[model samples]
Target: MTILCYHSVDPAWESPLAMRPGEFADHAAWLARHRTVVPLSEAVNRLDRRGRLPRGMAALTFDDGFAGVLEHALPEVQRHRLPTTIFLVAQTLTDEGLDAWWVRTPPPWPLATLTVEEVLHLRDLGVDLQSHSWAHQDLPELDEDRCERDLRQSREFLEDLLHGPVPFLAYPRGLHDDGVRRAARRAGYSHAFALPEGPERVDEYAVPRVGIHRGNNTRTLWVKSQPRYLDARHARRHVARTGRRLLKIG
Candidate 1:
């Protein structure tokens, strides 16, 4: 099974990493055309079922709980009758001033963010809301206590907001060490997502994901779905690392 991860979809440009609204719609349409798009829950449940998923079995997932998800992306997803999972940073669901990192970059664009109310609204729309963290920070970089707070508090807060168990988690910046993964399990998440270099199988703890970045077009997406393509990608990484080491020795 392939789990595709996205950040934001907006008309107004903010970062190169984000997808434009039209581009995102096109990706969704492509999935609808070629694959059996399933809900994260169903995919998890049917992991052991052999040959059940067709050639193009893909699941949609969005991280960072951007407002564009509720504003623009959800409608397109609903139109296609596709299920999506969104991981939210509990602290970002506010209209407060930009965080410190935003100061280092260009002035704040009118980036839409999911407010607490908007999250509730999306839940009503049948979107699965899960925890990203209290603040979008790299868990591996944080101490154990801080990691526990981010994971535990975020899940607790969202569960209270949605009035049920939040079963999924996407690590911020795709950063997780062994300790971070253990922290997530302890925090009550049934599964977690990582930016896998290739396609994913059914694993509750370390589900691999393919990131859809700004440069990803239809051809690139197709290429990424192939297992051989993943093998070649890994091989290229190996070659690059070997060359870097050789140069250092020289």
Candidate 2:
């Protein structure tokens, strides 16, 4: 399954994470023509089975519940009738400011998050909303107790808001470790996503995803979506790790 990840789809800010609305529409249009884009749960379930999906099977996932996703991205997704998942930072989803912790204090242009009402609207529109975390803090950086608490609390908050089992988690910043994965499983998430690269991923809890960034247009996305490219990326990463070990590079 090619689980493609996206963040904000807006024209307001140009970020590595931000893909312009038209660009996203182009990507979605291509997927409609060429791929079997399923919901995140379906993708995870098929992944658990390790069964072969239809030709060009892909899934669309978004990290951080950006307002632009509802405003811009969903229209394209709706036009294509693609099943999509948006992982929400619970605190941001509920906050008056409606922005992530880091984005609240920062530096760049203001980061936008989905309003509580918009989140409910998304649910009404049949978009699957799940957990990112209570806040967008990096999971691995926290202690185990804090980590588990964060994961559990995030799931709880989302379930409370959406009134459904928040069973899936996409690790904030795509950051996770063995300890964090253990915590996620303990916290009752059936699946967890990471930016790991490879077929031989660490475990089911650390499912890898290919990120879609501002630089990726239709052609680049198709290239990145191919198995050979993903396999080659994994091969290169393995070689790099081996070299680092041999050279004692920290």
Candidate 3:
């Protein structure tokens, strides 16, 4: 099964990486026509039992509780009766505004984020809410103490708001080290999503996600769904980055 990750669904902003509402609608329509869209929990349960997913199964996930998700994405999701998981930063839901990481860009680009009320409303609409982090910091870069605080505190805040446990988490920037993974496990997360550039074995922790960014459309999405192509792409990127680092050092 392939899990597609999205950030925002707004088209007005020219970031092709963020799927526009129309593109999202089309993707949903395609999925409804061609794939079995399952909830993340059910997918994990199946993986735990049989070590394989049913044919044609796919899952949709959104990282960050962007306002555009509530405004644009949810409607399309609901229209298709699709199941989706959303990873949210608990602090972002508060009135204090988005973290610096999500807002490092110039004005208007970083201005879109969901309010607390909008997040609650999305919860009411059957969206599976989960934790991102407290301040959207890179978990692997932080010390153990900071990592633990961010992971546990974010989950605690979300659970308190929703009155239930939020079992899933996506690492900020899809970054994780051994300590980061350990921290997530300690925080009681059932599963964590990583932007690993391809599909991965659905373990109890560290499930891989195919991040959909600018320039991803039906063709690229289809290519990413295949394990062989995805693995090759990841290898290429690894080599490219290594070469760049070597050049810098030289």
Candidate 4:
């Protein structure tokens, strides 16, 4: 199954992570035309059972719970009537927008995140809400205790607010290690996501996603939507990591 990841959908913000509304609409329409867009939960279920999705099936996910998603992306999503998921920074629901590393002083636009009201509204609209950690910290950099704490707190906060289970997690920056994955499982997440270049040996915790950036057109997205794209990319990353480790030992 192909899982697509997006960060922000805004016209004014020129960040590569931000795709213009029209472009995102085009992308959404294209997916509606070409692929069987499934809910992330269904896709995860298939992945768990068969370890892959059937051909032409895709899942949509937006990371960080950006306000732009509600403002811009939701209309296109609703128009297409697609099942979508947004992995939110649990703290961002109660606080201001994300405090990210990529933003400069006085960012080009406000790094606005979704509010509690907005999140509840999204949930009501059938958008699946999951954890993106508490502070969007890189999990691999943190020790096991801190990593587990972050994941546990994130899931707990979302569950308390939504009054339901939030069993999925997407690692911040798509970064994780064995310890981090173990923490995710310990924190009660049934599945977790990482980027294309994340670890090989795929399982629920190491599930890979193709990121949708501003530069991705229909053709690029088509390439990404291919079922084997992530597997090939993961294999290459695994090889490179292994080679570097060997060189260091040699």
Candidate 5:
């Protein structure tokens, strides 16, 4: 399934990962007009049942528990009745009050993050909640014990908070290795998501996603959402990577 990954949603924020509310709305409106936006689980079910996603079908996903998603993003998706999955950093979601947890590391603009209560409310509002990581650390850099601990702790915390199975995981920064994937499986995650490096593969534990960033317009979204877009994207990325290697050798 083609899942669109997003981060912060605020008109004022100035980051590639940040998209203004108006632009975000336009993208969703475009999807509602032209394509079918389904929940992550539904797409998976459809893929399993039919061996393919139906034409014009896609899913929405968010990484990091930013408050802007609550303030801006959710209203648009809710208006369209589109299902979305949010992968949250367990430590960033506070039970007390809103804080600067949205800033992964002192971003240029002020950021607000969703609280523990806000996330649960989102789940009640029909958004599926899953693990991003315990502290949003780079999983691949971590070794076996550390990686497994990070994955397991986050899964247990989210499942306990959401009161359901947290079966899916979105890797922090779309980074993972064989060790990380194996850790996720051992932690009880049935599926895992990676950042958009290229097309989505059949790997249940490392399915790639298309990142919908700040500069993307409706046309960009449409093109990226196409079934063969990732195939073409992967080819381009492969060529560039190979060229860089060859240049180094030369």
Candidate 6:
């Protein structure tokens, strides 16, 4: 099974994380035709249970609770009738118009975040809301106690808001270490996700995701949707980053 990570979808925005509405629509249509899209929980459950995931199984996920998702991405998702999930920074739910760390202090353009009512509206639209962490801080950089606290607060707030269990997490900035993973386990998340460059050992707590960006077309999207693509990309990036670090040390 494959899980995809997306952040924003806007026509005017051209950042690495923002995808044009047309591109998103195309990707959604491609997935609709090529894959059996399922809910995030179902994919994770099958992975956890070691059950055989159906052929062409995939899931859609958005991170950071961006409002563009509701504006642009939602319609495509609805048109395709795909099940989706959004990982939210818990603190941002109550803080409308508050620019997240990425959008603050010299952001290229205003990046609007979703409010509580808006999130509830998405929930009404059948989108599962999960945690991206309390403050969207880098978990790997925090102490064990602080990391656990942040993760717990994120889950607690979302569970309260959603009136159900919030069992999944997508690490802030796709960054995590062993201690951070332990903190997530202690914080009670059944699984967590990172970008394609995640740790070598793939498990529930460090699932690799294929991040969809502005430049993705049908060809790139098809390549990314493969079941083996995630691990293979992870291996390549891990080696590349490790080499860079070794060179710096030398």
Q: Which stretches of candidate 3 lie over 4 Å from their true place?
A: 48-53, 103-110, 198-202, 227-229, 238-241, 245-250
Query: Residue by residue across 1-250, what tens digits does model 4's lDDT show?
Result: 5889998898888766788898899999999999999999899876643246788889999988888999999999999999999999887776554555433222465578888999999999999999999988778889999999999999999999999999999988788889999999999999998874534557899887888888789898988888777767667777787564321000
- Best first by lDDT, ranked: 4, 6, 2, 5, 3, 1
Tens digits of per-residue lDDT for model 3 on 1-250? 5677888777676653467777777787887877888998887765533233456777888887777788888888999999988888888876675653653332364546777777788889888988988878878889987898889999999999888888888887777767888888888787787776323334556776777765576767667655445457657766676454321000
TM-scores of the candidates in the order shown: 0.84, 0.89, 0.87, 0.89, 0.89, 0.90
Residue pairs with clashing backbones, model 1: none
Which model, 1 or 5, shows the larger TM-score?
5
- Cα RMSD to the true fold for all candidates: 5.0, 4.0, 4.1, 4.4, 4.4, 3.8
Q: Pick the candidate with the highest TM-score.
A: 6
Candidate 6, superposed: residue stretches over 4 Å from native: 48-54, 95-98, 103-107, 238-250
- lDDT against the true structure, per candidate, is 0.71, 0.80, 0.73, 0.83, 0.78, 0.82
Model 4: residues >4 Å from true position, as ranges?
48-51, 95-98, 101-106, 235-250
On residues 1-250, what C-alpha lDDT tens digit does candidate 5 reach at each position? Answer: 3678888788777777788888899998998888888988877665532123667888889888788899999999999888899888887754543344435434665677787778889989999898888887778789988999988988998888888999899888887778888999998898888875633445778776778888899999988888777768778877686454321000
Give model 5's clash tally.
Answer: 0
lDDT of 2 by residue, 216-239 (tens): 899989977775555677788777
True-structure lDDT of candidate 5: 0.78
**lDDT, model 6:** 0.82
| Model 4 pairs whose backbones collide | 1-53
Clashes of 4: 1
